[model samples]
Target: MIDLLLQYGLFLAKTLTVVVAIALLMMAAVRARRGMGGSDDGDRLEILDLNERYKSLEQALKESCLSKKAYRAYVKAERKRRKARDKAQTEERQRLFVIDFNGDLRATEVAALRVLVTTILLDRRDGDQVLVRIENAGGTVHEHGLAASQLARLRAKGIHLTVAVDKVAASGGYLMACVADRIVAAPFAVIGSIGVLAELPNFHRLLERHGVDFELHTAGEYKRTLTLFGENTDAAREKLKGQLEDTHGLFKDFIREYRPALDLERVATGEYWHGSQAVALGLIDAIQTSDDLLLTASETTDLLQLKYSAHKKPIERLLASLQSAVAGRLAAWVGR
Candidate 1:
């Protein structure tokens, strides 16, 4: 009889556990449905009302009709209200997209920029601005040039575009920076290296020492201008120099067309200047960091920094922490 009672108790416990598991699963499903759900019509109506209010406030502020103190107070209150409304209406409105490029100019960076620009073109409302925080030391001509052209498309669509350079923007990087409606640079950011360069090491002597030979072939007269193997001729050197000169001329022309106020001859001397010096040369308009610009713009327009990062999941974070702890223990053991 006791054995039978024990069996019954085990069965009851299992039944209860299964019931609890099912209940938890149902709760999770309900929450997931809510998170993935679309905004209701009522929410849309609320957003439209808030937008109308924002427009009214903007118009009032523009006409200089309010006293200074009143204007400040109104703006402060309005911004607070708008922020709350936006947070509540997150399901109804689109988010501001920010593209951050902080590395070498490569295909991945270009592709990211392309997608960003395309998104802005599709999602940006009228009067919205696209901010590009660019930090590049420059790279291949064609690569960076393509990136700049992508930014130019924003301007073509009547969208406002601003580029903030926090570090060096030299050579091809400057090409990208020129397309912005306004360029803001950090106080000591490196700006303007309007030049092109090509370098090759001739291995003729090194190969001779090793008693090795290399063959060369060419279909066109200037197919291989500064080569690493064959003897370099005056003709080849001159040809390469001419190509560099042509590229430089194109770079100068592009800058002049975009920033016509700049004295191209004076500033395009393959010289890099600090941010303040760049302002004097008309390379950049203002010496302000992106943080300052964003803060100031927030007072006038809605300021946002958008990023697409592959954040670590909870399990991944836990594993990483565990691995770090193990490594630390191993190092301590070695020190002992």
Candidate 2:
């Protein structure tokens, strides 16, 4: 009974925190909407040097909860050697511009993507390379297409573009990845799903059962072929199917234009493959993880991670707060 009460109390606290976070966000959004958002910094750019990240890694290693015998021995020697060499080499001959793309179903990161790429184009010069670490399970067609086009801009500048997939890149994700000069993925990371897909629930029958009527008007005959509340005709369904086919064809053409080595007919069948399998199908150029790629780049080049700093909106702050709270609670629960 005591434990149950404690759990309930914790749950209530978390719920209240989330509610407060959301309320603050709503207030902030309303103020911004009314042009009264004083001091709300729009987005800003944040650049993190990969070599400097080792400081955090060293701290984390020291705080490891796992058995640290073999790991400590190896990392200790490497760290000492790296420290000795760091003083001698203040700069590298080649520089790698790293961008991270963590996408959602709507390709929400496309705005950041555009900003980062444009900045690189303006500032980067010869002997520089762009490495995009992308983790996306694909998203809306036009949105991801725009994201891929943003990547294409780097390629157009004769920049050596390398895409590193750490987790998964399918559908629209693969669309963007294929635009790179090289695609690298982990041994078991998901790579390809070069197919277009769209789905929406239709409520026409439910509306009919409820005796509710819905009428939609459009300028063209095909303006709104299939709708959520309207009865879909056979023609409407066929038209949607035809549109999907056309989109798929363009997807294939785009990939072929960029990655001519890939066998489009086989890989573009809406089937996803792991890194090794993708490499075998010529969908991915190499089988390696993004972490390894970053470490390698740090050795041969100055690795700089690019991020667009934007003044966090109310919702963004709220989300970050919620994430931090949840992580803290989870860590406590795990005794970590």
Task: Kindly list the per-residue Cα lDDT of model 1 for residues 1-336, writing each as its tens digit.
Answer: 999999999999999999999999988887787788832222110112323444676767654987888878877887999798778864434333346765453423675577667756876686777878887767678888888899889989987778898876777778989988899999888888788888889988888789898888989898889889877889999999999999999999888878999998888888788898999989998999987776556444554454433345689557756654553453233223
- In order, how many clashes per candidate? 0, 7
Write down the TM-score for model 1. 0.65
Q: Between which residue pairs do clashes occur in model 1?
A: none
lDDT for model 2, please: 0.83
lDDT of each: 0.74, 0.83
For model 2 the TM-score comes to 0.74
Give the best candidate by lDDT.
Answer: 2
**How do the predictions measure up, each by TM-score?**
0.65, 0.74
Q: Which regions in candidate 2 have their CA more than 4 angstroms from the true location? A: 1-42, 55-92, 315-336
Q: How far in Å is the alpha carbon of 133 misplaced in model 2?
A: 0.7
Clashing residue pairs in candidate 2, if any? 42-311, 43-309, 43-310, 43-311, 44-309, 44-310, 45-309
Compute the lDDT of residue 146 as modeled in candidate 2. 97
